[model samples]
Target chain A: MMETIGIWVAAFLTLSMFSFLYKDNPFYKFAEHLFVGASMGYFIPYTFFNVFIPYAYNPLFLRHNYWLIIPFVIGLGYWFRFSNNLGWLSRYPIAFSMGIVGMGVPMSIHAQILVQMRTMMLPLTNINLILIFIGTVSILLYFFFSKAHEGLYGKFTSVGIWFMMVGFGASFGYTVMARLSLLIGRLQFLLGDWLGLIK
Target chain B: MNFSDYIQKIDRRYIFIILAIAVILPLLFPLGLPTFTTPPVLSLYKHIDEAAGTDDRAVFMDFAQSPSTLPELYPMDLAILRHCFLRDIKVLTISYYPQGAAIMQMAISEVKEDFPDVKQDVDYCNFGFRNFALRVPITLGMGDNIAEAVETNAAGRRLENLPIMEKLKNYDNIQVCMEISGAAPGIIYINYARARYGVDVAIGVTAVSAADNYPYLQTGQLVGLLGGLKGAAEYEELVETFANNDIPYSEKKAQNLSWRNQQYELSKVPYKFKQARIGMDAQAVAHVLIIIFIIIGNIGYFIEKRQDKNKYVK
Candidate 1:
C-alpha cells in the first residue's frame, strides 16, 4: 500500500514537471518548490551527520584537536554575513578559503595545463595526432587578439573556426542526448515502475 | 503566413506530443537496436578485467552524481557494479555529493540482491559523502592509509575493522579509481590521486561532459570512459557478453551463480539489467525525429528566402 502511494506521488510529480512543456502552470510551480524544499531538508541533516559531525565535531571534541577549532571558527564567521554590523567578519572565512584556493591554483595548472600541453607536444606521427595538434594551434591562433587575422593568419583562424564549430556541434548533440535520456528515465518510471505499462 | 513559413513555425506542443509518443511507443515495444561498444568503453572493461582480481588490487568507485542525473548515470553505475561483483573484484565506494549516498545505496542493493552470499564490508563497502573542499587532502590521505583518511563507512561504522580495508589500505591496492559522475572529478583524481600515487583513473560521465574528456583520454590520463546513455548501454552489453562467454561461474556454488546464469541465457537479457539498452531505443527514435525536423525546417527557411528574393525582383 505504501509502495502504491509512493508511486502515485512520483507519477504526479513527473506529470507535473512535464506540464511545463505546454506553458507555465501552477502544477509546475508546486513541483519546483517542493523539489527545492525537499532537497534542502535532505541536505541539512546529511551534511550535519555525514560531514560536520565526522570531520568537524569529532575531530575538535572527541579527538581534542584544538587546531581544528581555528578553521571551525572561520567557518562560523560565515554566519556573520546576515548581520550588517558584523558583515565584515565574513571576509575572514572568504580570505582564508581564497588563500587555500590560491595555493591550489599552481598545482591545478601543473595537472590541467602543463600536463595537457606535454601530452600535446608528443610526436605527431599519426593522422589523429596531427589533426589534434593542428586543431589546438589553430584554435589558439583564432583567439589571438593582439595580432590582426589576415592572409595566412586569416586562413588559419578560419580553419580554427571550423574546428570550433565541429566541437560545438558534437557537444550540442550530446546535450540533446543527455536531455532525452532524462526524459526517457522519467517516462520509464511512470510507465514501468508506476503504471506497469512496460516491462 | 506562407506554406514555407507555416512549415517552419510548427507549434512546439505538436513536436512535444509527437516526441512523447515516439519515446513511449519504443518503451512499450522495444526495437532491440544493436549497441556498438566504443574503444574508450572497451578499454575500461579490459583494464578492469585484467587488473582487479586479487585481494591486493581493488576498484575505488566514486559516485559523485545526484538524483537529477540518475537516468543517464545510474545504469552505468549498475553495469560497473555488476561487472565488479561478477569478477569477484573488491570495491570501495564513496560519494562526493550528499545525494550520492542514497544513489550508491540503491545501486548496491539492486546488484547485491542478485548475489545473496556477497557479504558487505568484505566484498564491498560504501564510505559516504565527504566535503568537496577537502577533496585534495582526503584523496592524498587515502594514498597513505584509507582507513585513516575515511574513518567510517556510510553507516558510521569504523573502516579499520572491516575485512575489505585489510587489503584496501592504500593507493597501491586500488587498480582503477573510476569516477561515475555527471560532473566528472577527473582533474582532481588525476592531479592528486593519479599523479601523486600512480593510480589508474577512469570516468563514466554524462554525455554533455563526454566530449570534454577526449583530451584527457588522448593524453592517456584516463584509462577509459563511458559517456552518457550510449556509453552506459555499451558497458551493459560488455558486461552481458563477458558474463556469458568469460568467467567460470560453474566452479562456484550453483545457487550463487543461478541468478546471473538465468539472466543472460541466449538472447534474453533481463529488463532490470537492460535499463540503458531499452532507453537506447527511445534515444534512436528521438534522434530520427530531431534530424527530420532539422531537415524540414532548413528546407522551409531556404524556400522562404527565395520567395522574399522574388518579391524584391517584382
Candidate 2:
C-alpha cells in the first residue's frame, strides 16, 4: 500500500513536469519549487546526523580524539563567511583545502596524462591504430592556430573537421537517447506500475 | 498554403507532441529492435563473469549518480548488480551523492528479491554515503587498504568482521572498480584506483558526457564504458542472452545453496529489471521520428530556396 501511494505521488510529479510542454503553468512551477525545497529540507538533518554525529561528535567525546577539535574549529570557521566583521576567518579553511588539492594535483597527473600518452604512442601497424594516430594528429593540428590552413595543412584540417562532425553527431544521438529514456522511465511507471496497462 | 510552407511553419509544440506519441507507443507495444553489445560493455561483463570464478574477489562500485541522471544510470546500475549477484560475486557500493546511497539500498533490495539465497553481510555490503569531502581520501586509501579506508559499513558495523571482507582486504582482492555516474567521479576512480592501484576501472555515464570519455577507452585507461540508455540496454542484452549461469561454486557453504543452481530465464526477469531494453524500444521509435522530421525540414528549405531564386529571375 505504501508502494502504491509512492507511485501515485511520483506519477503526479511526472505529469506536473510534462505539463510544461503545452505551456509553462502553475503545475510545473509548483513541482519545481517543491523538489528544490524538499531536497534541502532532507539533506540538512541527514548531514548533521551522518557527518556531524558519527565523524565529529563521536570521535571527540567518546573516543577522546581531542586533536579533532583543531580541524573541527577550522570547519566551523567557514561559518564566519556570513559574519560581517570576522569573515576573513574563512580563508584559513579555504587555503588549507586549496593547498591540499595543489599538492595532490601532480600525483594524479601521471595517471591522467602520462599513462594516456604512453598508450596513444602506438606502433601504428594496424589500420585501427593508423586511423587513431591520424585522427589524433589531425584533430590537434586543427586547433593549431600558428599555421594557416593551406595545402597539406588544409587537407588535414578538413579531415579533422569531418572527425569532429562525426563526434558531435554521435554525442547528439546519445543525448537524444538519454532524453527519450527519461520519458520512457516515467511512462513505464505510469503505464505498468500505476495503471497495470503494460506487463 | 503549400505543403512545403506548412511543413516549414509547423509549430514546435506539434513536434513535441509527435515525439511524445512516438515514445509512448513503443512502451504500450514494444518493438524489440535487436540490441547489440559494444566491445567496451562486453569487456565489463566479462570482468564481472571472471570475478565470479574467484569466490574471494569483490567488485567496488560507486553510485555517484543523482536524480537528474536517474533514468539512464539507474537501469545500468541494477543490471551490473544483478550480474554480480547472479554469478555469486561480492559487491561493495558507496555513494557521494546524498540521495545516491538511498538508490543503492533500493537497488540492492530489488535485486536480492531475484536471488533469495544471496545473503547480505557475506555476499554483499554497502558503505553507504560517505561525506563527499572524503571522496579523495577514500579513493586513494582503498587502493592501499579498503578495510582501513572504510572502517565501518553504513550501519556503523565493523567492516573487518563482515564475512565478505575476509579475503577482500585491498585493491588486490578487488577485480574491478565500476563507477556509475555522470562521468564526473569516474575520472577519480580512473586516476586513483586504476592508475594508482593497478585495478581495472569501468564507467557507466549519461550519453551526453559519453563522448568526453571515449578517449580514455582508446588509451585503455578505461577497461570498459557504458554510454547512456543504449549502453545499459546492451549490457542487459549481454547478461540476459549470453551469461552462462552454470557456475562451479565450491569455496564455501554458501555456494551449496539451491538458488545458485537455478537457471536464469529472460521470461522470469521482472519488467522493472528489463527497463533499459524497454527504454531502447522507445529510443528506436523516437529516433526514426526525428530522422523523418529532419528530412522534411531539409526538403522544405530546398523548395523555399528554389522559389526565392525563381522570384528573383522573374
Best by lDDT: 1
Compose the digit string of candidate 2's lDDT tens values, residues B261-280.
23334236567767888888
In model 2, state the lDDT of residue B41: 82
Q: What C-alpha root-mean-square deviation, in Å, does candidate 2 show against the real structure?
A: 4.5
The sequence of per-residue lDDT tens digits that candidate 2 reaches over residues A1-199 is 9988998899999899989988999999999999999776756665675567767887899899999999999988889998999998998887876665753576568777777667778686799878877777798899999999999889988898888888899888878777877877787778888888886
Candidate 2 chain A has its poorest 10 consecutive residues by lDDT at A98-107
- Candidate 2 has an fnat equal to 0.55
Interface root-mean-square deviation for each candidate?
A: 1.3, 1.7
Measured against the true two-chain complex, the DockQ scores of the candidates, in the order shown, are 0.71, 0.65
Q: In model 1, what lDDT does residue A196 have?
A: 91
Model 2 regions lying over 4 Å from their true place: B53-55, B242-244, B247-267
- Candidate 1 similarity to native, TM-score: 0.93
| Tens digit per residue, CA lDDT, model 1, B103-177 | 998899999998887789998998887767667777879999999998888877789999988878899888899
